[model samples]
Target: MTSNKTDLPYFSVVGIGAGPANLSLAALLQARTDQRIALFDKAADSSWHSSLLHPGVRMQTSWMKDLVSLVDPTHKLSFLNYLVTEGRLFAMINSQFDVIPRREYMRYLAWASGQIENIHYSTPIEEVSFVEGEGFYAISGGAPVARSQHLVIGVGTRPTVPAGLSSLPDDRAFIADHLALHLPTMSSDKTAPVAVIGGGQTGIEAVLRLLGAGFSNIKWLGRRQWFQTIDDSPAANEIYRPAHQQYLQDLTRGTRRRLVEDANPTGDALTPGVLRTLYQANYDRMLEFGEYPVAMLPGRDVTEGVLDGKDVVLHCSTAERLEQHRVAYAVIAVGRQSAPVPFSAELRERLDAGEDGDLVIEEDYSVRWKGMDDHRIYALNRARFSHGIPDANLTLLPVRAAMVINSMLGSELFQIRDELCPVQWG
Candidate 1:
């Protein structure tokens, strides 16, 4: 029934990662509550997708979906305020772009990170364990550095590589996260064959970047019938509204999962701008070389790849036939998987788990774990099925943060009002 302060530095809450999800949570709680919350990240500094901040890459989501706007529009940390305070408001308007640049978003996140009071960088949390009466302890560097009454895990996702390509040496093959870093070495041989795997936005971006870098021979592979652009139409956009998110809760888990899958074009596809940019560039190049530089290979899933001397051989299967392609370099952009939770054995065994060992996320984003008396662990961006597609996107970030804060404080500190439904579903 007692705890000592000398054992570990304590707080009301501790966030595992300082990415967008937890950053939004920290910003809201910092502005509204006196409760002490700290974040620990293994990153050496504050950065979001730093290496992949490609020169031409832009955000798919609007800037209005910033961290605090949906719940607290007037908060000093709004994206509008960031633009104004940083002296870029008019400059941004002059550009007349549909979406902000990814680099700008990363800068906004870094700026927000600096404003938040307690974010411990370069501090890796290896284990998060809960003792019966003492609350949660975040162990770092082989010792418990911090303790908290509650925990929020928002470490984000990691790039994935298939088993066939995983064994390739670092120089020959890697995920797209390292593309920028490898561009110089890659550009040395502009005519060398390059293979990019996966069908999503990342793969398309990789192909586009290689084309921009004067790479002559590039093979772009996709599992789908064709490359797809985001359906950001008004009706499709309505799926990301908070009203739609709540409506999803009433449906069965199986049905909710199906809807999220069907809404893939909204988030998982390429931006129309990027697709058009590639097309125009390809057209211009064809005028000079009499052929397109990048070969678009769709309706084919790359089943395996192997290192053949300095080259990588990719085995792919299409509806009609099987094929093999060789390339000097390979970039695997096959999507991402959620980052692992640093839960200790004692804590992990007690939590309600799904078939995949993930925490069973409740409607409020908190995980149903044992011994959650006054303390809780909230998982952000981990419940795509239950919360709809917006659960894993920037659209409802502030709303989710507000819900978590409201549930944590047991009162309506921040009111979330999504009014006027365009579509009513049973």
Candidate 2:
């Protein structure tokens, strides 16, 4: 570890993690103001959800909701501009996709990231501390790399496997992201059985990937009674608007949490297009094999797993009774939990946290800390219950960034206007 240095590069804002959230903020700050900004990420290069960009997989949100479009459509880094600049405008127009492919979105983000300035790649910030009079310092490699008046935490979530499956052999049972890496080691026979645990979008995607890999016997398990598609109706979409988010903030904490829980189906379920594609593919395989290649086992809550000879046996509890499934391999796609914010012990003690041990975020996404008079810390993608479902996904990417910018600048840098609301939250 290198020694701490007093003289470090100074910036108006030092953002950790070059994911979509900070990238959105960086693009906006570059376009709207001349403030000194820097973004640091641990990855070697720009990529978004790299492991999960399976063939035929698509984004759940529309293309219009790119990094800088919804708030500042004229921004040079808009998704439309990327296509036009890259000579794919006409091709994209002709494709006429309801939602663009996930690979395409990843490519767009990489392109936009290339145009942004002061983004430090392959640099992982270990801890952030405050110096009282000197603002915030981002420490990396046991020394201060950058100092800034503000810090943004965007070190996105990580895939999680439950405690029961945690002890499973890594070579046999692993997270969904490792499916491709572990696939070739498993059986090459198309009829070999494999199990995909989790019923949400990621689980379905894993099952689809297995199908593409010619795995005829696939067990798809989930806790839900049945595989459910997203609620894509206009009324359901209203939950993602700025108006609904503002109204949610006005309610009591208990009421807001309950309302957000009720609104999960709007954005948390599987995409309708992907579900339809899976159904059609399953039907096509059934026509040739006289039976379905994939067996849908919903309403089963997976409880434990243990090795049985060469097979991994999964024990689950259903609505009726307990059951067991023996498979060659299991892909766990349960869910994701937030990656921790590496705050120094002193700094963390000065900050306020919620009952869930997350930062107490303000309306503008800034944290409620003890000594925030001279400096501030803003967190994105960490405010789902407070900001609603849009906080977790890419639906209102730029709008959220605009709110953070306006709050940082102490002015209406971007006017967020949502009009003609038919539904009354009151």
Candidate 3:
């Protein structure tokens, strides 16, 4: 077929969302192959998790698990190289922190992004469609802007508010992503009652931020029996390796999903020292005042939230009873859901979906779609059920990218070798 849009820019690969996953893939593709690759993101800049990047808050993963090190340690855009080239190597080491600050990580990402080529920020690819024999076309603002032989969707996740709480007044109740933006206009009275929902790290960080902002009356709610810390032990860390990921790939879908859910405690819980920090801050506030400034309520599952006059009333249930709490404002950090892909209706219908209604992703991360020949679409961070816990995080970022690149090129361009495994997988 003759190309009609010959004047427009064309790439071998067009990746949506230049987040860490896509950034890793783009970096590797640029270094290893002569492939003309381009990445498009809706965000104006590479400020990852910017809203929840509170001061003193640290990353859950180690600095070693950066974008490129796992598969290509010698890559020019490795985190170590970033520190050296940016003149922060000695200072970063001297800090001697358990984990580096997330703000620093964001800076490292932005720095690395600047060095990469053909990354178009502030450009949203609204629709992606596949023409019969012409490959993929990325449409923005109702017109095709770029053509690509391959597509990679890595748009990442967005903070989700529960359906029950979705109707809450937007100004008074909101997701954690907007907490920082809404803090100033919150309340003139520091003691105004507020609630931070969800038991994960984001929820704790919200509580800490409220305390720091001089909020005297704050309630921290969690569905679990208690606020849980991540299992950062040696054994737990081993699950993040490539070997375990491969082991997970061999399991049946149902079995793999169950195992991955079981592994959530290893990475999904609160970061170490975060809960302690919250507790110590509450204690100090208690010492100053007659009572603790923050109230920790665990095992309370918030089922509904409604605006009662100026306050947001949260209806929660416990193991034995139901209760209600009122607060001037609520910051919801329940969890995040995957961002929607911009696939056109025709293309969406042609893709093979799983029992879960998501695209059927193969072991190598490519989506099983109709009419796939030399052109293919790869999905990143969307195969948790088959790829295990590491699929949803920065742990095996480069390794996943390598898998996609190897599968795309039909050769072993990058080798992933995870040796010295102590635990055997069945």
Candidate 4:
């Protein structure tokens, strides 16, 4: 339905997705009350890292790196505040690490979202277009409605399933995203071997979870020699330090992009301690009950897989460079790919063409297009290639949110840009 101008906001900032990145922006706007903002997500409610939420999975970043602390350290809704409210602050301080459980972190995010007003859950922005002279138009749940001023596209990334594996029967195979929720319902009598693809955190976590759940005969296959560890050392995390902000802000765009790609830090992966615990658990189970449910086949690339009779056979080439071995059920955890925005063909064409596209931003988190002089269409996840490493990830979300807000307010709240770090990876 066409919303009346009186009913609609005159200077509204539309947030496309309600994930942590955009949620941080929403929280900032709510805190400042500078502009009329409405945040939307396709999901029914707020969720963070639901796919990898095994019982013991915890955040890789400390609670201090939450939605607002990096931008405004004194923010009340910070993770520290959440821990205090939960009565875990004192105990958490005594622990070696400051991370909270994934479930608890998710709950804290949901709580933060609830406290913010004007956030519309389950409302997905279908398309956004700039109206000549009349600000912008956002087509959400209904007819195209004009929203004056700005728009923020924070839709996030889509799960990256392998190219050949999409045709597999849904009942037989699953992605890491759906495994946790659906694994319990899977048939218990089947002795079929399960193969998990990808060497990333999700793949490792999936293997561990399956073994923990009493599943037998699970194979974890990865194309890489070994899973790469994140640079969590105090010195490395200096990328997020305030001192590095000037360096990042002054670097060239191309250099910034290279730095992000080379870093390739995957969060929430099992630490050395956690990996040891998982190995000990598997070993204990094997020794006590004569059951070894898990096996690691690193440096193996999946060439092909097909449903053979009652079981799925995964053809994999290992480091030994031998022929492929067939296995049943493949869980591809290769991670997500960047998804294109659902804009009209005209807008897409305009974006592809450099003339209008340059006006379309690759820097700062805001989405803007050509011809919309008075309005800016800022993106939360779209400018990763341009804005550098911190755009999509939670690593610099608090700072990114502040930057977007500052851009909207015509202020310089966050001037930190991407800097070219020494090439640590080849």
Candidate 4 clash pair list: 160-336, 248-417, 249-417, 314-327, 366-378, 366-379, 367-377, 367-378, 367-379, 368-377
Candidate 3: Cα lDDT at 277: 90
Q: What is the lDDT of residue 419 in candidate 4?
A: 51
- Return whichever of 1 and 2 wins on TM-score: 2
Question: lDDT tens string, model 4, 215-282?
Answer: 77888787877655666776566555434543455677677667656645634234555566567877
List clashing residue pairs in candidate 3: none
lDDT of 4: 0.70
lDDT of 1 by residue, 139-242 (tens): 88988888899999988888888887788899988899998888887648789999999878788888888888899898999998999889999889889888
> Taking the candidates one at a time, how many backbone clashes does each contain?
0, 0, 0, 10
Candidate 1, pairs of clashing residues: none
- TM-score for candidate 4, please give it: 0.87
Candidate 1 residue runs with Cα over 4 Å from true position: 1-4
- Model 4 regions more than 4 Å off: 1-7, 86-88, 91-98, 241-256, 265-270, 289-291, 319-322, 352-360, 413-426
Tens-digit per-residue lDDT, 186-290, candidate 3: 998998999999999999999999999999999999999999999999999889988998898888899999999998899899986888899999999999997
- Tell me which of candidates 1 and 3 scores higher on TM-score: 3
Worst 10 residues of 1 by lDDT: 1-10
C-alpha root-mean-square deviation, candidate 1 = 1.7
Candidates' TM-scores?
Answer: 0.97, 0.98, 0.98, 0.87
Residue-by-residue lDDT tens digits, candidate 2, 123-220? 89999988866888888777788989999899989998899999989987999999888888878777878999999999999999999988999999
